[model samples]
Target: MAKSKKKQQTGPDIRAFFDSMDALASEKGLGKDEIMEIFRGSLITSYQRKYGPDARIEVTLDSETPAIGVSVHKQIVEEVEDPSLEITVAEAKKHREDAAAGEELVIEEEPFAFSRIGATNVRHIFFQRLKEQEREIIYNEFSHKEGELITGQFLRWRDREVVYVDLGRAEGVLPRREQIPRERFHPGDRIKAVIKSVELRREKSRDPGPYILLSRAAPEFVRRLFEQEIPEIYDGVVEIMDIVRDAGFRSKLLVRSNRSDVDPVGACVGIKGVRIQSIVRELGNERIDIVNYSPEPAELIANAISPARVAEVRADSGTKEALVLVPDDQLRLAQGPDNKNVKLAARLTGFRLIVKSLTQFGEEMSSPEARAQLEQLFSPKTEEGAGEDGDYTPLTELPGLSGRLISLLEQSGVKSVEDLVELEPEELEALEGIGKTTATQILKILEDVVSFEEV
Candidate 1:
């Protein structure tokens, strides 16, 4: 009767255990269902480690109270060998009169009250399991945010290598490779980064939680800035056709207007360049070129080399080559220092451009040898005529050539008919604005004019 009364007190202790868990769940903002699961898992793990692998135990939390109960289940066999899994048939019959061999029986028992060391071990296991579940939750939450821009506060710098940022809910790492050169980060600095990736680690380890990779060097950073600064771009009225960036130095954006009345460049530049200036300030004074997109290569190239006047744009129909002519005074501006402007324009327009000064074009056009060659090829039997300069004759005045075709030939260095006759089809095609097909047509026209001279 004393043993029976002692057993009656065990239920109250189980109820108190669960009541503590409920309070913890409320304070930590953890869900009751998740906490209950973790508690059950910890109980099973602790029991197995102490009693061996075959130990059969069930752990449950009381629905209305903060109580936990652990029941050891055993098979009622004819004889008891393992105290953890099997019980004697006589012992089982004491609890259930109809119990028989191979029948399963459950014995309700209080967990052996743990010693100080054992209690610490149990608490450690419970917290470890909870931490593992929390990491998994964090991993799933941030994984979906990859490639998005996030705002965080600088926490600290480690080994002068990695920068740690506190992202409100989680910590993120900014590796040296992802940070821009010369950019400084200090403790408590407000920083922005693009979520490069999220990497999961082994569940039960504490070396570092699931890694959140952050970057300030990605090209998308500029695109995201434009989207934020330009209402038209954010609302989809302006589309970014292409972007070419030199990381922190300069970036070029080709934008197109969706509506006929909306100017994409004007929208991005804003009034007095306020919109673009805001973005520039954020990027450490990086230069931004917001050029209008054009389907025509000539127009596109012209816009790409902005603030540099284009005297002429000659494109080869077959080879898709373009020669951009700028006045001699504007050559320096067109090509920029060390050809950076031209290089950026090429990348922005998707065209391989040969930039030539107008003076150079004029030199090739007005050469005396070129005029004499033209006269011999067009009219070998006719008298030589003089015009402005030593022997400059309008190429259109030559028989069998239209003014437009003459202008095309002049732009291509074929100053006279003699120059045209000296060129092979391949050589002619190599000139700006000329293709194999056009070369063939021009050669045919020159040959007919020559045959007429013989007659």
Candidate 2:
């Protein structure tokens, strides 16, 4: 009578227990079946620790309803060999009517009969497994977001070197080296950064999930911000060729328009500088320059060094070097704060840019060596071979080229056979007066005199 009363008393509590488990599984984004399986294993461990390791125990859980059942299975023998695993026939008959020799008798166990220590062990196992499962879920979810922009709230600082941001399910780590120099953040402040890496750490001392390392200083961070803020770049009307940055100071982007009507720089800057201003505020007022991209090295260098208008750009194709001439009054602006403007421009254009004022260039031009070089450059060449071997032939002497084509080539700085051979077909076609048909004719005529492979 007393056992029947106890069973009735605990029935509601068992149902409530399973109900809470279901709620927790749903809230954690874990499978209900997996959660139940983890608890079942925990129960098994508790039972084995109390009643010899070899004791047979079975745990059953219902999928359709919140119900749990546990049972103990022991073999019936004439005499018990192991008290925990085997039972005598007389004792087994009390639980089962069909108890016999060499047969197993099943006895249902109470929902839980855990001692204090056993209960603690079960709770530890359950939570440890649950936490590990949750960590795995978080790791898998965030791994795909590497190199993407994410907005998170600042949580706190660790060791005065690492900044922690609450990314909802996971915490993002912003190391000191990855942060923009001198940038400050307060708790609960919203911050934006690019996911630099996702790493899974297995050390026992650390948290289980993969570490999401974030960065605000990386060039890619600025690239993602441009993509998000600029409608033309997002929709493919304008393309970003490259980006260079000195974080917290300045960043330069090389952009080009696929359509002739849309100016890449104007689109990025927006009407009265609204769109770019929003990005600037987000970056803590870092200077951003939008430079137009050009295939011509001289034009590209001139465009890259901005804010201080370049008077002229002189480039050497062989050495990949460029000299940028700016107005004497704008020399300080061309160098920028800490000379970062010219440095970033050089990186963006892939040229070693030497910036000089018009006055400085004039002074250099007055030198005897510079004058001699200039004279050699402008002087008309006689019908003389270019190299010592005397095998060099001039482009005018080559057949199949029209007089007009030769004049256009010379006007665009392709004077000799050596200069003509260096230009690709697309580059020739890009010349001011050159057409696709003319470019094709030029390549064919050059092929007859010089084997491109030998050159």
Candidate 3:
């Protein structure tokens, strides 16, 4: 009756112990078997620490019975050699009948009591192992997330420099260098950043983390934002060729479409600029220029300089250099603040860009070096004033044409008399900065230079 009463009394305590173990596994994001193995190792360490180091101990945890049982193992010998490892057969038979020499006997260790120090040591080891496992879990989870955009709550800044964000299971560190200079965040605010890297701490410290390093200033951050906000990019209908960023100031992306029906730039911009506006607001209203990818270097360079009209792009395939001519009014705009626009365009297009106005290029053409460059540029193709069959003359080389008219024509994708002749007088007047007088002057210049034959 007393044995039955004692068993009933301790049943709930064992069930409670297993329940807490399950809770710990869930809290630490560890498997139940992993927790049990860690607990078993801790028990062995604590038992060896309390008794002699030579003690042979085994821990058995039964989930079906919801019980934890500890045992001491000993070799049954005719004569005892070591008190901890070997026991006399006479003594072994007391626990197990028919115990023979050279056989091993396992004795159930009931009422397994730990000293105060032993209990503390076991607790420390158990939690430390749990922490290490948790760190590994977090590391594996976030490692694949590198170069991906993630949203987290701003916790606090460490040392007033590094911003710490709580990412649920892990903490992300955004150093001051990776933050956009113009952006600010308050505590408890939701902040979005890209995972720059996953780093493991080597030092034995209180915080054992495979830390997630985050960034808002990286070019990859902008790339990820575009992928997230643009459905075509995500679905592979439109592909991003390259991304370059001056981080909080500006960014440029070169994109192309695989399908003929889809326009890459128009798709990224969305109707009325709704899609790109979301990405811009996410980036703290950073300037974003989505350039259409072109195999022709001249067209690509012209498209790269956006919001600022390009009058002409003369690209040399050999030297990977380009001369970008913009109108006088668009010179400053093309160069952008601190020349970020041109610099980013150069980086994106893989060209050394020399941005110039029409007057500036014309004045430089008077120099011998500029003249030699111009001659070499057109030598293999056609000579000056060579507008014969299947040949074209540059509008700049045409006589009696003002620089403004030449620049306006070039800005409208008309580089030579061949391209100009294709446009009607009405089409010429429809161009920006061109009215009835300018259109009449352009047509008169074309007529005087070329002998037109009626078909």
lDDT of each: 0.75, 0.80, 0.81
lDDT of 1: 0.75
Query: What range of 10 consecutive residues in model 1 has the weakest lDDT sum?
Result: 1-10
Give the poorly placed runs of model 3, Cα more than 4 Å off: 1-13, 48-56, 63-66, 76-101, 105-111, 203-207, 373-455
lDDT, candidate 2, 1-455, per-residue tens? 00111122246667778788899999988888889888998888777776668888888776445456667778889987797798888887777666688887776766566677877898998988788788878888998889999999999988888999999999999999899988889977999999999877774745445689999999899889988999899999999888998889988889999999999999999989998998888778999899999889999888888877989888876556677888988888888864668778888887766678888779879899877754544344455633412333467787888889889998998877756765657789999799898888888888776643111
Supply candidate 2's per-residue lDDT for 130.
84
lDDT for each residue of candidate 1 in 243-280, tens digit (9 for 90 to 100): 88765667789999999999998999988998789888
Best of the two (2, 3) by TM-score: 3
- For model 1 the local lDDT of residue 160 reads 92
In model 2, the clashing pairs are: none
Candidates 1 and 3 compared: the better one by TM-score is: 3
Model 2 TM-score relative to the real fold = 0.69
lDDT, model 2, position 265:
94
Which residue pairs come into collision in candidate 1?
A: 14-67, 15-67, 18-66, 18-67, 19-66, 374-417, 374-418
| Regions of candidate 1 where Cα sits further than 4 Å from its true position | 1-29, 51-56, 78-100, 115-118, 203-207, 315-321, 329-332, 336-340, 356-455
For residues 13-59, write the lDDT of model 3, one tens digit per residue. 77887899999998888889999899998888777765457879878
Predicted model with the maximum lDDT: 3
TM-score quality measure for candidate 3: 0.73
